[model samples]
Target chain A: MAEKAKILIIGAGKCGRALVELFSKIEKITIIGVVDFNQDAPGIKLAKTLNIPTAVDYREFMNKAGLNCIFNSTGKAQIEEELMLSKPAGVEVIGGCSVNLIQELIKEREKVEQQLKGLAQRRNNVVGNIDAGSTPIIPKMEPPDFNKQVKKDEDFWGKDKLIESIIQNSAVATFVINSQHKVLYWNVACEELTGTKAKDLLGTSGHWKAFYSHQRPCVADIVIDNSFVDLDKFYKVYRGSTLIPNGLHAEDWYSKLGGKDRYIVFDAAPIYDTEGKLIAAIETLQDITERKKAEDELKKAYTRLKEMQNQVIQAEKLNTIGQLASGVAHEVRNPLGIILQGVNYLENKIPAKEGDVFETLTMLKDSVKRADKIINTLLDFSRFTNLDLRPEDINSILESSLSLVRIKFESSNIDIIPEIKKDVPKVLADRNKLEQVFVNIFLNAIQAMPEGGNITIRSYGKKLEGIENGTSRREEGYFMIGEKVVVVEIEDTGVGIPEENLKKVFEPFFTTKGLTGGVGLGLSVTKNIIHMHRGIIYAESRFGHGAKVTVILKIAE
Target chain B: MDRKRILVIDDEENFTKLIKWNLEKTGKYEIRVENSGLLGFSATKEFKPHLILLDILMPDMDGSEVAFQLKCDEDTKDIPIVFLTAVAKKEEVEANSGVIGGHPFIAKPVELEQLIDVIERNAY
Candidate 1:
């Protein structure tokens, strides 16, 4: 064999580094030295690690034995001309552009070599798998060479185009990102979902732009990072997928997708190469905006249905109690009347001058009257009498109710602030019953604030909009959307009802007042009267703050 | 003033008796008691009181039927009938100015003063 050819690379840059690595691997050539102005240049470092001679000055190696060739990679003409003039007689200097061409040819050859190695390995895997499985009978055919077989395999798999086509034509939005977090594939479905073209997104790390207003890692990026523990910090709802190992799923509401609000679900999984190395991550997206809206609507409808069911049960219970109350009233009131009349007779026959006799009879009469009052309240609570409905102004009714309780308010040191709106529409309601409702509410407010507070009564006409829930009121189609209604709100700055008791305030026999204050039927009776008028009544309170009772009645046509 | 005559018609015997005693003790009226609506109607013609204090919800006959019969008659139609019953609510009675069904009404367990006021207003 001839003597080995000694090569010298100049510039110690990327091109020079490629030349050094390539010549070092050749069997018939040896890299004699590397030269660069920068001591820390990549080629100089690599050449030093390979135990080749390196220097900041090329003249140090100029006279070395058998240094026959010099590759100039710095792209400086003055350095090339100087090297050409001072080089030994047998040595030749290749310029920067020519070195570049030689580097390209070498790189191309290495790439082809890597491809052939990979194809040979893949072919072995295929043949090995086929041998391990049960054989299938086939017609005799000629065996192809390795190159032909590799070509056939490439055509059969159509790896890149087939995967891209599958993703592009899929109805579900999908995208893939490599380990460097660069978007490798952004399919047509993804384009439609995000309103971003593939040409602008491919090879970029801007997949987050489709779902978020700011820069952030998407699910696929997180998977590629293998940072699932920090998923909660980025997503409100996220969980590990049950189907795929090392897979994750998350849901979020994006406000700016396609210029519309959308609820999106992301399913991301780590894609591994044949050697079980995580090479990339794939993420599939689903637009669940309509499904989420429907779910919310279904939730509202279920709540309404539950409220109506409770109302029907309450009405039935009240009806049963009413029947029982009427029966008891008829049976018990007659005897009470007899006792009261007897006490009156005894008072008349035995004069007041008798020792404690008139007092005793008065006490007896008082007890009888109290009993009758309770029975009357029970009767009122259970009564379902036809409303003597008439078109009447709500302001006037509120004023009348306030007037009736004015003396109580003053005595209790309570301030009455009437914010009644003028020209309020008339509501078809029984005047007496509605007056009773307001009076009961005012009395409750007064009782609530025995230490003196403010009772604000506000009345206004409004157009009904959406149905309200969880207000101790039933939406039973009594009030239509856009219907005119008179709303009366009575707010009291007193000891607010506790949150737990807010819902029970309208239930029969549920009262915060002690035994002497009331029989727990005041709000129940009030709710009944309002319902009879086809109105809604509900109470709201923040504990330790205050209580507000609102009554809504439809305006008469 | 030949004390105004009043008749008490109620199914409760003790209630009617006490009412009669209480009204007579007032010395402004003479009282008669009947236990049933049917008997009360017959006694109305016999006693010919100035006012009829009728109890509704009586078992034998309802007070409204008794009132209907009295109004249908020639002699008793002129007499005023005041309903003293447990069926009417006091608030409703007061709200309607103590009158219901074209006649005066007083809820039962009534105080003596209110009862007297209603009776005097309705009686001739």
Candidate 2:
């Protein structure tokens, strides 16, 4: 009997439990104890059932009698280092990954020894039959290249055991096929990934069962066939194919294997014999589903970041325009003031009896007045700060603002229609500034309906879902999903805004009315004031029909 | 018994001339114009005006600086100053009886009647 090796296991985890199961079955090794900080670990519970001793610390067994090995399964390098530094002489420390490797090697050695014993027994039976003058017919089972001189491929793969083990243990799924599409090499990793055993697939041409339900040419089959034109007929819609050194690479989405879709990348290369004859083709597959998912998410995030960047740039441009307008308005007003006074002086000095002279002065005076109005509007649009906020009724503000323009609208033969929803919520806003915003919009509606049409003022309060698509501009500056808001829609039945001009309606100095007194600042100033109130205002129109201007405001808490 | 004497100081020549002509046209006052603040300050001593109409933005010295200097001087300290500016809001000027900053400040391009009303209210 061999000398029994006494060993201790450290860190009772899954790995430790596995080691215990393997070491317990071995005849030459005896487990002294299993140690773990967690007393209730799965491995510790399993060791207890086997009557093995358990401890919270393994240092107590450092100098134990007859201990030959200490297996450190902790996976922590520091703990393994400390154990190695303190191990007693004559004891071996098999730690970390090598512990599992040693366990596998021991099982392999046992299997090989059993096979040798069976071969020896068969040889004895054959010799006895020969003595009786009886020849038994046995199938020839020999490794390839038994009669031929060492071929290049046989010398490289068959003779080299290290390369054979490397191919068997490769992490990426790989398989080799002959010209007949027969699988010659199916790695262990490939079996684990496809849930097919290598023993069943080897020497068989049914390798397509791993990826597809029906018979189809895999990448390795195409390499063996060497029919490049058939690639498009078989895999017509691959992502792309690249020519690598002595290989072709392609990636595509595969779903025939009854599971979640997988984006697999595969490379195929032809293996040639020493005389340059094609012997086999090998194909390697790598699952890139997670990496592709992360890349798509990053692309979406980058797109959102770019959109925010554009909005910031637009806001900066608006700010610059506001500053420039303020400077220009101030400079123009002084000269305009002087011109107005001069015109007034001339009007007084010149006699009214001189027809053209007095009329021309009146026209000049009117032009100066018009210029002054434009400058004032420009100044108003730029100076949107120091807002006075208070909780005020939207209905009352609409009513008062309408009253300011009611007389003008009535004189132009345009009917005024007020549709105020009762019990509307109050909004936090500057009462005077909000009034100015309503007044400007009302005046615009009135101007749009110059040919005697009805001006409808609709007011209501409700919770608005996020702004609808197609009108993204209204929600760009300010709005949250599921916001409580009060809406005032001022619709006019007149020549509506053109589709092309609808986007430009809120822009400064963009007006459809030519020669008419549409300074174009009415909607622009209204937008500025509403923006200051943290509200939204937008216009919807049909070219030949009428236009509707909607204003949305947040409800005060 | 004598007419009200006024001194108008502004950088705009045409504007001051129009104000002088408009005020003198009323036949209730005699007005003198000066384009520069320093020149206008000296004219105050020689003209001995009852009231001063000053422009806020001037070349050499602004209206506030001139007002500070006049207030410091013994002879000119009693003279009331009205600011004529383009920056003042028309409605604000009208709401406060045409007076701004405790003194009358009229928005420029004022109507003749409105300007006379502001002058009468502050000149005394």
Clashing pairs in 2: none
Query: What C-alpha lDDT do the candidate models reach, one value each?
Result: 0.82, 0.77
| Candidate 2 TM-score, true structure as reference | 0.53
TM-score of chain B of 2: 0.92
How large a fraction of the reference contact set does each model reproduce? 0.86, 0.34
TM-score of chain B of each: 0.97, 0.92
Model 1 chain A: worst 10 consecutive residues (lDDT sum): A138-147
- CA RMSD, predictions in order: 25.2, 20.4
Off by over 4 Å in 2: A1-318, A385-392, A407-414, A425-428, A446-454, A463-485, A493-504, A509-519, A540-546, A554-557, B73-78, B95-99
Candidate 2 lDDT over residue span A1-557, tens digit each: 54577889998887788888878886667899999999898779989999999999888888889887788888888888788668887676667555555455555555655654665566568778888789953524322322353444434345535445756876767888876787878898787667778898887999988888789888888778776665665563342222222455667677744356877777788877655677788887777678778877989999889888866865775677678665665577667767777776777788674699888877877887777676667667455556778899999898888889889988989988889999999999988788889898877777777788898889999887766533365546566777778988999998889988886788777777776777677777788888888788888999768899888888899
TM-score of each: 0.59, 0.53
- TM-score of model 1 relative to the true fold? 0.59
Q: Is the docking of candidate 1 incorrect, acceptable, medium or high quality?
A: medium
Q: What is the fnat of candidate 1?
A: 0.86
